[model samples]
Target: MPTDISRLVHNVNEQGFTALEKTGLRGQQDQGLVSTLISRDLSGSDDLCVSWGRILPGQHHLCHHHPDASEFYVVISGAPLVHLGDTDYRAKPGDGIYIPRGTTHGITNDGDEDVNLVVGVSKPADWQFVADE
Candidate 1:
């Protein structure tokens, strides 16, 4: 059964970090900021997962890589710095980024507003291989 993403489970919780609980993290400090898992393999599609994340100013996602799946991120609001492989890009509303499988990437919200991004993965994530580097 295909789950309607619009009707999927959703929740927002305080992340314990003052900056994260308040607005979000800024710069490289965002590694532990707000993370919301919006959807998973509810449809039994072993090859897909969708998630929405918000990063507060000065916060960042640490360098990491996926071994079997390519990832895509669509900027829904605000601007953020994105690091993929050896390149750095600025992402804002309406922008999209595609990360190839096995590539190192991360995101940083250094602006004033909260950075919202919608992420989709080509394969159901393998938790054991997900490392925070």
Candidate 2:
């Protein structure tokens, strides 16, 4: 995917920072999940695709899985109910959650505050997204 400059602010050009506003790279998406891509394989140099994401209060997203890539979710603030494989776990702030390849995963935010999070997929360009049932 080409990098659209419209979403990028001067911070992208001034600093060596990549734009974090790109969205919609993964397919196991909850329509309500707000995602901002931090980096991706678009330039052929990115081995991972990373994003800053948010699950608003009271939102629950159905699970999805990556066929060929490992994934990770880091809780920046607010705990969300994290679903990995067939189990559910309560996540806390500053926790880095790891999901192996082909594991079904999703997240829910039932707290009063929004769940701020960071999500990453290794080998984004080579992985297949399966919207798990």
Candidate 3:
């Protein structure tokens, strides 16, 4: 995925950020989960991908795993109950959540406000989700 280097740099002010495709939870729609694409191969960076994501208040996403990318989520606001492997924890602002490649994980926003997160992946690859059933 090669991008034009003539205008490779990005800024939050100059152009609006791209929104991550609203792929529903496990092919189901209207799930109140939002992911906004911030960086990827189109950004001229093939090493990593980044996004801004949020779960609507009182919403929860089903468990899923990424096969090729180690995922990281930096809590930006609100408390999100994060489930990783066999354990779960309440995440707060400034907290960094790590999900190893192939680890089963999911998150929920049970609080009064939306759980906002800055999500990053080690590689710029299409996310491969394996439903934890």
In order, what is each prediction's RMSD in angstroms? 6.2, 7.3, 4.4
lDDT of 2 at 82: 94
- For 8-114, candidate 2 gives per-residue lDDT tens digits of 42232333323222224463335345443544433333677766676778776667787889989899999899988879999999899999998998788888998
lDDT winner = 3
Q: How many pairs of residues collide in each model?
A: 11, 0, 1
lDDT (Cα, tens digit) per residue for candidate 3, span 104-126: 88887888998778888888767
Kindly report which residue stretches of model 2 are placed more than 4 angstroms away from their true locations once superposed.
Answer: 1-29, 41-44
Instruction: Assess the local accuracy of residue 89 in candidate 2 as a C-alpha lDDT between 0 and 100.
Output: 96
Per-residue accuracy of model 1 over 55-91 as CA lDDT, tens digit each: 7777777767878788899999988999888888988
Q: Each candidate's lDDT (Cα)?
A: 0.67, 0.70, 0.73
Top model number, TM-score? 3
What local lDDT score does residue 46 receive in model 3, on the 0 to 100 scale? 69
Per-residue error (Å), model 1, residue 36: 5.9
Model 2: worst 10 consecutive residues (lDDT sum) = 14-23
* lDDT of residue 65 for candidate 2: 83
